[model samples]
Target: MSIMALTPPPIPRDGPLLRVDRLRQWFSSGGFMSPRLTVRAVEDVTFEIGRGEILGLVGESGSGKSTLGRAVLRVTDLTDGRVVFDGQDVSTLSKRQLRPLRARMQMIFQDPFASLNPRMTVGQIVGAPLRIQNPGISRSEVEARVGDALRTVGLADSHAERYPHEFSGGQRQRIGIARAFVLAPDFLVADEPVSALDVSIQAQVVNLLMEIKRKLDLTILFISHDLAVVGHVCDRVAVMYLGRIVEIADTRTLFRNPRHPYTEALFSAVPVADPSRRRQRILLKGDLPSPLAPPSGCAFRTRCRYAIPACAEAVPPLAHIGGGHQKACIRDDLALQPAC
Candidate 1:
């Protein structure tokens, strides 16, 4: 491996909204101490989000994107590593200490219909977090705050009185968004926020989120498998494969000049409008290996066309190519090219 300069400006920690470092979350199936088999849901992932910036996490179904998002939120137990939010290490925080931090960090799950409580009205759903965080707030104040939150997500105050089933899918998702933002959290982990909506409504929700981020000065970690969707709202993008980050760069740089073979394959999958023009699709071979027994070197090497013998001997560390771009592939000759 050759050493290259990592000169991109490091994420400012002075007041970063969120910082995750070498986070690893593993699940044990059944293994003796000798072999130590475990499913690495998230392994050695690191990134940062500025006060109001959106950091997109993109990957295939089992690439551990959602796991990383949940891990940072401390919703799931991490096997090891640190997650610092607003300068506090969440992993080490006691339940009592973590409770206070919940007021500043929240999550918006992927499924709108499923995430909402069918038994509760919209107001109750949105106001639950507020009540838990600040019990001293009056009932009248809770209603007022719930109204404001509903209005913020494009819903009327009266809508809060109705049940979630009464609303459409997009509208339910809006309620979910309202619930997450109701607490006025500084950081939010939005896992596939738009993937479940209609294509037309997807833009509406995404635009709403972008607007909310700007207006409220909120920081977000947007997780999605849709590259185009991620590119639309994220300031920077991180591409994951088999529980590890293979490439990360600014949104424009990642889309226009992806530097990882896996990232290139993902870009090629995005559908285009014109039927007359066709692009060569790079077909990857083999299924993604189980994280418990992932390949010795690069996790993607099993399906990578440029894989060499050296790729099997040692894992490739993330190396800077240029700008803020970084990749973990060994084959320089197979550097990623843009989609035509």
Candidate 2:
């Protein structure tokens, strides 16, 4: 059976299902006085996922989306800020205190093959969490729950005795999903769940996620670079860049009218189906900045077409722009092109 990197915990019945306040996750290297460098993977990010909300986190590679996910789950400790899950402060919880709560929070890793234990049977993989959290549970009960979870993910019962190596990529991912859902977790962090799958398989998995969310009443943090997938499955979207969120709004609002320059650039790249509506790609100037030493003031100022002298003076706050839409860019006069 696969083991979690760190045991997680649970929360209360009210408030935003998950509230992240000024969360920062930083890692330092060179302990032996080699001019230690710290990678600011997640810096002062704040967001909320209400009950049964699938909040999509969209960003380019190395933008710190995964790190933020792990930190929110307390799979890794945070360097600063607070993470409140279900009203409880998971960041302050100890391992012993977190273990029982682990059953309530789960993670769906990006690589289906790597996340599962190749040597273990599917039943073992799915039943592991129930056994760990409920050590007193009967063997038959574990088997029953495992079977149900497998069925829910569209796998047959006989396949439970088989190993992950015996399945296709999609089936392996289904097994991973079975394992994640077996615990009936209240909150899930699905990190690039469908990225490794084919286009067709991606739809199947995404549909499965939507169905399961309805069945489980789950609150999810759906992290992906695929804006199309995010648009289809997410209620709201938050765009991340250089370890910070640049824009956040309801899916329709953000897709129809992105306020941040980075968001506008990102949306412009997404392929539109209709030939009549070709989006002019807003090609970015350079690669992502190094997380170790990010640019000053506006991290995106170097590439932003609307950047000015004041942009390099201080970091722009993620401020409300009206009607629940929020943006980090300081300029409010420039009109951004609508991608779709």
Model 1 Cα lDDT, one tens digit per residue, 1-340: 3344556666565777788888999988655656656898888887777778899999999999998988898887778999988887888777787898998888888999999999999999999998999989899999999999999999999987899999998999999999998988889999999899999999999998888888778899999998888877889999999999999999999888888899999888887778997787888887889987898988898898777899998878888888878888877776566754
Candidate 2, after superposition: displacement of residue 70 in Å? Answer: 0.4
TM-score, per-candidate, Cα-based: 0.92, 0.95
Of the candidates shown, which would achieve the greatest lDDT relative to the real structure? 2
Flag clash pairs in model 2. 12-86
| Residue 119 error, candidate 1, Å | 1.0
TM-score of 2: 0.95
Q: Lowest lDDT 10-mer window, candidate 2?
A: 3-12
Ten contiguous residues with the weakest lDDT in model 1: 1-10
Q: What lDDT tens digits, residue by residue, belong to model 2 across residues 238-336?
A: 999999999999999999898999999998898889988755789899889899989999999988888999999999999999988999999998788
